[model samples]
Target: MQASQASSRLGQSRTSIGTPAAPRAERFRLTGPSVRLDPRIYAVRKDIADIALADRVFAPHYAEAEQARVAVPSVALREGPSDDARAVSQLLFGEGFAVIDSEGGWAWGYGLHDHYVGYLPAAVLGDMGAEPDHVVRAASALVFADADIKSPVVATLPMGSRFAATAEGAFLRAENGFIHSRHAGAIAAAEQDVVAVAERLLGQPYRWGGRGGDGVDCSGLVQTAFALCGLAVPRDTDQQAEAIGEEIADGAALRRGDLIFFPGHVGLMADGETLVHANAHWMAVVREPLADVIARLQPEHEKPVLSRRRVLP
Candidate 1:
């Protein structure tokens, strides 16, 4: 399902940002017109192909993915390699990207964190330097030219941004600038509650495909919350509902951390009766009674709660 219309909950949050691994394409090749692939996550075009899919797909050229990191605070991965193209998702600072091809100032590849494939401006990426040792845990963090807060703000990063840094007195020295140590947490530092991460992002503007503090959508909000805790989740709602957590049998009682699904939509349960979600209807992240959301959504859209999946013990 399209992320713009669907709802999904966050994934499990772990303490450490794990290593960025390349996507392992299937070993067997499928020959013929019936070979089906999801274009959203597979970097295959009529002329170019991700090396991982070389054996499974036909292309005149196949290239191995080069490791790259986002140098800018955030950049949009678009439908095409142009400013006018639709942004499928936003890549946060320090997120890993596997570049399978590049031309005319655009890089074609997929995100290492979620494997979403798209075109991004080539200028926003840099050589992957040191492995990330920390993640931005605050809703947003400012990068200062100097250790002091009064220094010029060079950049701003959304939550879930990762980086490698050294402690410089009371501040952390990142490649871009110094950030207050309090704004970041060690990659291994796990937040115990997933709901707390979602609550921290309340009031963010709802943007389609936005996954961080600058802007966020339904699934983006959930994905960002989990990423901060060091977990990678699919970028869209249908994928999230199909892959994340176990299905709760029908008529089962609801609990915190349950993924509440509607027609092309998903939300996280704050409690049995409360839900937190980023919705276009409200134009922002909102927390309210589950009953109120259901009442409003059902009449307006003719969609009811479809399923509830439990993601926490």
Candidate 2:
């Protein structure tokens, strides 16, 4: 089945951003020419002989041989090599991956961004090349085939998509199209106001495994916001809770850019009293009083806050 058709069949419903889907072990087993290996661990085809095994993630069954770049605006990273599998995450345009194995039109590999392992349509990948020079900062930006604004839009790049570019009059000459200079910034640009970046996604609907303006989950919201500022964070809540910035001993001390964690959710501190998140409760990105959110969740979660970390500090 095609990736798009499979995604439609699985249904893109709102899901808890805090919880990842069931372990790959419980999903499906690899068979035939593909050796059964832990889905979390990277693996390649069983017959390939010219394999590089320097990386710990590469073994007899797993080898690092093929590399590819994302060729679409966004592609699903699924639990299995089939389109019917649950989407665990998404690969934005221009993202790179190491192809460890293949099954027909599906490629199982590890995402270079967060080192996430999953399956994406082999058709959406291309040969890797030079690293991107700029990242799309807008929620979504139109890419024109020419520098003229009147020109037809060739593609729409979601926030966080990277591409090589050079100044061309009032636009930047990108690999696929011309982008307005105002919509993109240097990949190494200094971190800016994360709150402001998140506010742009205020009305975007919440989606499971979504990280762009189309839809976004709590951690995806936080991750996307910070990523625009050139900061990197884990993709899931539990890992984020353990790996991100310094922990604040007191919730009262929380300030802007601080991350607040709940039992299975997360939100960014807009200020001392305001919280911004892509919450299922709202079915969209919304800002609410921190106290009200804590009070509402306390009954069901049994705890108001799990941990507070200052990502900016």
Candidate 3:
């Protein structure tokens, strides 16, 4: 909707599959003001935009987003349409992509799961299939050509990736390959502990904008952890800092699963005094004393803690 027209629909809200209700007008207000629309989450370019935003923004053309799904195990969503461009995020197997446009072998769209907008190679997207029925529960699950353990591996699906499958003895028969039933679980199943899921990625390489088990960043780690627990959250640190659970007093004591934000960064509280994160300092996912993290980051950012939030009851 147009920026000026969105105010009237402020009370209207819609929920995505398996996610909480979010007011559409509220999102427009957050990213709709002609000058305020964030390209990172809104598919608006100088020439064209997603038809959904036609009311709020001006463009020579507004196109309907064609539905597509990630066909590869994982594909980088880059800042630009080239492989050399900085990767802004990743689209994992079976995750939906709303293709607003495609050109020069790249598809420009937003990930339906996170609303992260970027350019993914057109080859990585394919027809949207049946809704995913299973999710990889392990750090990474190998997809084999056949149900046999010795079968040739066809793909390596990251944790949190979803797919449709049918039980076949000890395996789940997917369209492309067979996955060990033990490595996957019903998509609707949710782990009770988000921190536990984060801990599983311990020692994983730290990569900016990477969210898979192979590599991940601070906010990516947080988002992945929450996602495995069946919770939906914004993809970036600043957004998480603002939209996540209620904030605590500056010096309030923290507990497990609490989110501690630092300027341009965030980490999960492993305990009252410990923090777990995919950090650049270590170049890997690691856990350390909260005091130590504060000491190391203080000189650079000044503020030791930006905000502390508790997400779990």
Which candidate has the highest TM-score of all? 3
Superior candidate under lDDT, 1 versus 3: 3
Compose the digit string of candidate 1's lDDT tens values, residues 1-313. 1111111111111111122322432222234542457999998877776756644565555566788999888888899989999989999999999988889999999999999999999999999999999889898999999999999999898988999999999899987889899889888887867788998888989888898847888888888887666666789998888888889997788888888888877889998999999998889888999999889877667558877887777
Cα shift from native, residue 290, model 1 (Å): 1.3
- lDDT tens readout by residue for model 2, 189-299: 845899999988888998888888378889888888888888888788887998889888753577889899998889998988899999999889999999999899878
State candidate 2's TM-score: 0.81
lDDT of each: 0.81, 0.75, 0.84
Better of 1 and 3 by TM-score: 3
Tell me the spans in candidate 1 whose CA falls farther than 4 Å from its real position.
1-34, 300-303
Candidate 3 or 2, higher TM-score: 3
Model 2: residues with Cα > 4 Å off, grouped in runs? 1-60
Task: Provide TM-scores for the models.
Answer: 0.87, 0.81, 0.88
TM-score of predicted model 3?
0.88
lDDT (tens digit, per residue) of candidate 3 on 149-231: 99999889998888999999999999999999888988788888999999988999999898874788999989988998989
RMSD of 2: 11.1
* Residue 238, model 1: Cα distance from true site in angstroms: 0.4
